[model samples]
Target: MTHPIDSTEFASLLCSRLCHDLLSPVGALNNGLELMADETDPDMRQRCLDLLADSARTSANKLKFFRLAFGSAGGFGDAVPTHEARVAIEGMFAQTGRVKVGWMVGDDMLNKLAVKVLLNLSLIAGDALVRGGQLDVGAEKRPGVTEIVVRAEGPKLVLDPELRAALAGALPPEGLASRTAAAWMVRSLVTGRGGEIVLSAPGEPMLLFGASIPG
Candidate 1:
């Protein structure tokens, strides 16, 4: 068993995760605005406009994805459409263009908690593809169980040992960092509900995640 995280501390950690992901694009937006204000050349001004637009889109995409993955999305529903999740995931990777997403979820709907687990795991798997590779996410519902798999194949893949430890509940709660918060959340949510999460060995060319949850 892992040490339980304090509610206040966990919330702070999650906030850190959100800010870290948003910082780059959000900062870009600010910088673009500053450039636009001083630029006199028409062509350079247009370039600034392009930068602003791209930053805005990136910010929006991240927010939308986080809304569903971490916040209250599909309000009041016990299940959320799998399609929505796919769109959210696609939009997030769309910004980079290097990472390609292959969604293979056969189920039309997933329970709220299952969807959260899928998205969080997908985020971690997607991040492992540092060189930007293929991400395949799939989930299936059986009579009494639901299984989810996230696989990443790339020229170079790295799953940090700290993240693996957090996902396995081998890291003490005090050791959890903002970078590994999502993995910790996945482990906590799945194991708290009596589910199990499997991870491929670190440094492998391909990274795979398997999660099983009882219905």
Candidate 2:
């Protein structure tokens, strides 16, 4: 069963999740600036500059990904170019240097809602690869429906029960939190369109998520 969440509360949870994800890199950027200001050695100063550069890159990548996943990224259009989403996903995992993304989306464009669901599910699957892994993202449009599939495989994969529950639309509204906001959003988006989500078994060697929504 799908539990209804208030719009205002859901927005708050998303905001909190965004802030939490960006905090570490943003804080590193600030610290790097402070260190550069006080450092006298050229090598140390150079190191600080390098830190700043990496932090800036990470922050930018995350913002780009989140813009598409959680915000209005493709402007006011009803459809967004699939390449943009491909780039966003690549940039997102590039920062970690631990996960490789394989994009198999054949469509040139996807509806805005489909883009959001794809990105969010990809985000969840990528995060499940605790010890770094391969993430495969694919989507297809057929007849009157859009289908999305995300797969994660690694030596160590961990998908939290709460997130799984949220994705399955079995988590209660009162139990919602920032960590599960994206999963819940994916659920809401799919179900709102009279769609359904599928998940691999808990003990499976790989983590998989699939969604089919009527367009």
lDDT of each: 0.90, 0.94
RMSD, every candidate, angstroms: 1.0, 0.8
Ten-residue segment with the worst summed lDDT in candidate 2?
Answer: 88-97
- Candidate with maximal lDDT: 2
- What TM-score quantifies how close candidate 1 is to the native fold? 0.97
Output the TM-score of candidate 2. 0.98
Best by TM-score: 2
Backbone clashes in candidate 1 total: 0
Task: State the lDDT of candidate 1 residue by residue for 1-215, as single tens digits.
Answer: 55688988888899999999999999999999999999999999999999999999999999989998899898998999999999999988845888999999998999999999999988988888889999999999999889999999988887888899988889898788888888888898898888899988766668999999998
In model 2, pairs of residues that clash are none
Error in Å for residue 185 of model 2: 0.9
Per-residue alpha-carbon lDDT of candidate 2 for residues 68-148, written as tens digits (9 for 90 to 100): 999998889899999999999999984578999999999999999999999999999999998999999999999999999
